[model samples]
Target: MTGLAPNVQLFPIESILDLVTDGVLAIDQRGYVLYANATAHQLLGRKELVGKNCGLPAAHGVGGTDLQLVRRGDMIWAQMRSLPIQWLEQAAYVITLTDITERKRAEENLRITAGVFDNSREAILITDSNNIIVDANPAFSHITGYSRLEVLGRNPSLLNSGRQDKQFYAEMWKTLNHQGAWRGEIWNRRKSGEVYAELLSISAIRDDSGNAQRYVAIFSDISYLKEHEAKLRHVAHYDALTGIPNRVLLADRIKQAIAHASRDRHKIAVCYLDLDGFKPINDSMGHETGDQVLIEVARRIEHSLRGGDTVARLGGDEFVVLLRLEKDHECLASLDRLLALISQPITLKGSSYKVGASIGVSIYPRDNGDADTLLRHADQAMYIAKQSGKNCFYIYDPLADLRIRSQNELFKSIRQALEHNQFEMHYQPKVHLRSKQLLGVEALIRWRHPTRGLLSPLEFLRPIENTELDILIGNWVIMTTLAQFDSWRRNGLEIEISINISAYHLESPGFAHNLRQQMALYDIPLGGLQIEVLETAALADIATVKNIIEQCRRFGVRFALDDFGTGYSSLSYLSRLPVDVLKIDQSFVKNMLEQQADKTIVQGIIALARAFDRQIVAEGVETEQQGEALLSMGCEIGQGYGIAKPMKAEQLQTWHQPAIEKTR
Candidate 1:
């Protein structure tokens, strides 16, 4: 164990082997373990191995061969080297054993890592310092539709889509060189002659001196994801029904239009349009036909304007047009063409339907209104055009809309009165003309204005007609009438009461259902409640009114066409409307005795009602002579001051008692 001379014979073999760190083995030409050292016994897990044969092959010139050994039930690796040495001064072989379990484990891990690199799903590419692709994984070939042999030694530029410019590549390299990595979206071409988008990441493999030796790129195709994103973006900004810019995109477009107008010193005209007489078609033909009509309308409006102009549907049959104009006169021509185009006839389901647009224009910079205000002003103008006999366009006039806007206070007061129960229903008696018999009463709405005393519908109702206010006030009238009827029924006043329903309420989809709910809430008899709709309301959408009438009839409710002959009522259209009664307009009745033309009109209406087998009620009858004339003309029912003026619910009982007694 001390020291040995250069000659192996000068040292004890066992001592020399014990002093060495490696396992020393002596074997004959047949490879038997004749001499085993302490380290070899410990590594091989065997002690009595003096005659055991170690069958390990020869090592290649200083490079050791690997030998497997079992130690304490665990498999381990050892480096074995066979050397020709003097063993017991006879011909023999010496084997050196070195434990290399940790090194073998490192090599196994490297093999597994290489396998993962070749089999990953993401395309993998490796490039040398000269930017030549030295290796490509199977995934790279699958993604690019090329073989690894086809792409090896070629530059990655072969897959370039030519979408990235020289500057883009320069910036990419700059960032990659500085940060040691680069990741972003890129466009690349496939071997199948298709271009696609990909999310790519490149990492620099550096040498010990910090110089890049190779680059590893990993990428995934993201074309489908990008396509899905584009689809979502389109849906967000476009109307699914019409495939045009919706309200969301329209606002953004208007903002851009305004900015452009301001910079170029040009004016933009915002025109708000509404289709006249479209409701009846939609109500009659169903929503499918309605959708077809709307599509055609959109197409016509879009084609009617110049290329730069935009027409967007604001829902329903309403559309907004943006016209770029250099002068005020330009608006006239554009509006004229649009109106003409929209008024053209559209044929659907083998029937020709004609609808006209009422257009209201507000010029930017000239009107001094922003996008929202301009839209509102144009809407106001559109209402004027409709009131002025539609199928026309009108420029906005602030002075004209002043009175309309000024009614905002009165509107607020009406709403407050409704909320506070400051409104009342007045009952006007409709009586049998020949016998003075008590018939049903018409319920009229009256506002007890606190400051202005009692106000008739004529004073404030006209301002809110055809608006949501009308719908609100109409609902109030209905609920109040039902409650009043319930109270009257409790007191033995069993007369049917009819409440006038506005066009807005009559055309509402839930009108019949709402009425049934209210009737149920009040516990009133079904036939005890009657709905009086204006002749104009019925004309607005005949099919809708017919459906509402049919639905109400199912619940034992009756319908009466009020103020008949005041609208464009024809026998053909009237034949489609199902109602129980037709009330002659007061204008024709109030002066029928004084004016012969009024008398002829009333006679004709009475005759028409008789022909149609409809009960005729004369309104505004103020004299016994007028009642007698109506009776003579075959009109039996009369309502007005002559029959009985509209009286409070409390007065109704007392006023009806005398009429009942007189009828006896």
Candidate 2:
């Protein structure tokens, strides 16, 4: 309608309305479609709209109104605006519809976001690129104790608790700048100057050009959680009764001490201490008094040590002390102080109570063990100290402990061997050296160890000596020897058999009865079975041994004094042992050919045997010259490697053939 250039072509009103982005439709007053643009038909998904009725509100509306249009089962929002117009001289209202679906959805999303920002529990803070606070949610004001009006335009550093250094913030900002986001725990101060912990997440709001325009931080206060976690950690690591470090913490301290000691080239002592009379005190007195006493004791011990030293309770009356020392002797002074301090009477509930501490110290580098091993060694030594006397400290000896452990392991192996029938008898011939006659055979025990092969009595027997296992093995040897004797007799090879018994077994109750019963089990002749007791063993209890030998003699079980010269028993006592045979110890016999002193000792033994009216046998004869020397010394019988090595029963049968022929 107005200033149009003649050169410009004028388009139809329909084409002009179709070019508009918004859908356009014209409805008459009767709600009939008067005109519809291409966009309106496409938006409504209808091909024909000229003759159809288009629903419109009968009102003169100045502002636009929203209307819902159904298209393919989907409701579409459209904005309608009405105006009075004349169509073909008829009075009607023209209604124009515009599709507003996408804009409405965006407005709804913004409303929901705004609601979330206002009601969220986590604090939200928005800052401009220059790090000035621009906006804050209500949660931010509640958590930081700062009002929105007071915090706006201020930096987040205003709430710094100073717990974190500048480098921490520098690193946080560095991460945020590089990664566009950062999340971690941080400590901050509230408006009331109270410090608190928070789990904070910060994100950089970046523009399309990859430049940060603002920063948004979301955080939750974690101070209460942090406090609760600290309480749990304390309860876990500290003893409730004594208020000292418990075993769990003690292990950590010991490891740290070990590491420091190794690095500094110093020493650390792990001391295990037990209150000697604590159990009685806890029983006689009430538990309250006992608890008080323990607390006092723990405090005293903790204060008595150096600053770096640690005292820990391993439950009950047991406590472990970790001492870092420059020298091992330094620990001794501290331990002595501990014993004295613990011995001092503790007064509780108007009653004076006295309890002593038995402390065992295992020094690092000296004990040369791990933390657990050191503690165990100290515990073992503590028992030793308790056994010796209360109120004392004992230093652990790893070598001696190792020896005891090895002996125990070997004892277990030996016991298992006996149970599994791994023991066998080896026979060494006792012969007349001058006549080359086989007199009898001494039964020597050999263990066919599963892993270690054949083991001599010297290898495994000594550990069992004086133990109940000694009695069991001794009985086994006697029974085994008698059984072999029966076997030989059945084979027409009647030979006397002798077995060595430990002192404990000989002194054991019912020894004579057990031996008599065992001998009766076989068909051997009277005095065919002999028991060789070591001279040292007989000296253990001379009267008991003499009585045992007499009891055996009554049952035709002869006795021999083995290793004759090894014991320190008086000659008078030796004369009353009631043994029928004297076997010279191997030490003198083995060296007699080369040494005059050994030869003289051997000769003296033979003379004593003869004077005592007993048979004499020289052991460990290894050469013909030695055997000849023994024969010259008037020792007629000998048992040694020079004669014949100890052989199994099966081999002995074959070996005896040559000796049998010689005897013939």
Candidate 3:
């Protein structure tokens, strides 16, 4: 106040103090506020302060302390400092309050970050922009077996295991430079010279201009996890007992081999091998010995093949081999070697045992099939080898397999046709050739195929012969023929109907019973329904067939011997079959005119039928001359396309009248 220039007016001390950022106040010894600056009023959120008690601890001398002050119902941190001062010549003190909320928060965050960096389980490493190791955490030392002092000032590449190529590091750096961070798994060497895997995350500490200044890396050791995963992978792809590839890995190998073979225009021989006489040995000996036998067999197979080739166990005494071959003979040679080696005696537990292998091979590109198809073909061929005297190898024939597959598909279609009522019956007329009189009609089956139209019995019947379908079709024909006879009788056309039963159906278990059940369904005229049994059928069980024929005769039904000369039965056996008529096979009848032997055979059948006192019908009488010749031979009854082609039931009623007029 004494240092003043002329004409200069000094501002009040309280007003000058309000200009400072810190809050200032003057208080009496009793703690009552005497003077307060504008900042103090703002900090305390009160406009008036004089004569008011400042609710705070008494100031001890002149010192600084942190305090919490209530401002507008909110608590805030402040640095409070006091100074002993004279206010209006009375005892008082001056206090200054500085808001330090932001500083306190920043200090607390630094403490937490420091604690985390010190105690984290994950290894942390910090490097400068030049990739020089600047600092490392305790976890880094623990995981890598390197002290912090040893790593400082060195390049991070010191931990490289040399497993990754330069290009790998180049790509990683490229990603880091573009994105400011990179996270991945890396293989590195520890300080102890041991290789290990780790999941690592690296971040670039950038400045305000987004330029990288430092790199922070955090990683966790995963060596034990990798080892565990490898073990699991092996279990999945390998057989536990034999240590060879299992079925799953075999499939993968075969697929890879097929790809390579197709690209290189080579061949792969897929062989399915099964141990012969192994089950007997396994049953007689203990299962432990059986297991040992299988193990030895696997080892022999593996040793017999080339290095590139693979042998896989398909469980239980079965194993598969895949050979990469350049020629046909290579596969043969390998297969021969395999058989020889497997047949060698094995000595285990001081006992000598022998086993032979039957190997079936399907070659790739030649078979032109996928992995699964090739495996299946080889398996089928293996069975063939087993049946043809074990201890041998056979090559799969695709052509033969194709034929079997076609037959199976045809059988399936026939079954579906029966279930969907796609089958129908047609009748071909049998007539007295000399008198041109209609004798009866033979019932034939036709399949109304959805896609291929109607099919003849010749197209579908042969494949199902001796199978259950044959019996089913034979039964269907009989029932259908009986129903047609009833329909004809209702229409005032009473005619005899005959049906051909296959050899299987005639000899089936319930043939007699099933036939009796069908006959009872309609009012069949005496001898109006005839069951024509193949001559071969009767020859199968002559006594059973004779008894069946005699039993049917009691029910007013007649039986005929169909395809007569084909079976070539003896005269003594022929006389014992009590059939009413004999029908010559079409093969002999159709070619009799062209072939002398056929003519002679046909003549012999006619003579035999007559000698036995049985009526004869000549099948396949296609020409008028053939029909005349058959009549001259004392065989008057005939059926053929020359007489009348097989027709539906509706067409037959209309066709019979015209046929009778033409014959007359």
Pairs clashing in candidate 1? none
Name model 2 segments beyond 4 Å from true.
1-12, 22-33, 36-53, 66-73, 419-422, 448-455, 586-612, 620-636, 651-664
Any runs in candidate 3 off by more than 4 Å, and if so which?
Answer: 1-11, 25-36, 40-77, 80-96, 274-294, 315-317, 340-348, 351-360, 379-395, 486-495, 523-529, 533-580, 585-602, 658-664
TM-score of decoy 1: 0.54
How would you order the candidates by TM-score, starting with the best?
A: 2, 3, 1
Question: Model 2 residue 259 lDDT?
Answer: 89
What digit string (tens of lDDT, one per residue) describes model 1 on residues 1-664? 1222125454465776776778777777666766777787787777655666756553333667887888889999998877776766667776788999989999999988788888788999999998899999898888899899998899999999999999999999999999999999999999988999999999999999999999999999899999999899889887777887777787777788899999999999989999998999899989898889889999888777788888888899999999899987888988888888888899987889889999999888878767788888999889889999999988997665677568888888988998899998898998889998877899998989899999999998988877889889998888888888888888887788898988778887698898888888887776777788787653466777788889999988888888888877655546887887888989999898889999999999888888888888899999999989988888998888877889998998898888788877
Selected candidate, larger TM-score, 1 vs 3: 3
**Residue pairs with backbone overlap in model 2:** none
Error of 1 at 221 (Å): 1.2
Tens-place lDDT digits, model 2, residues 37-115: 7777877778777757756674657598888889879988988887777765666666667889988889999999888
Q: Name the candidate that leads on lDDT.
A: 3
**Which is the better candidate, 1 or 2, if ranked by lDDT?**
2
User: What is the lDDT ranking, best to worst?
Assistant: 3, 2, 1
Q: What digit string (tens of lDDT, one per residue) describes model 3 on residues 355-471?
A: 999989999998999999999999999999999999998899999998999999998988898899999999999988887778799999999999999999988998888988898
Q: After superposition, how far is residue 549 of candidate 1 from its true place, in Å?
A: 40
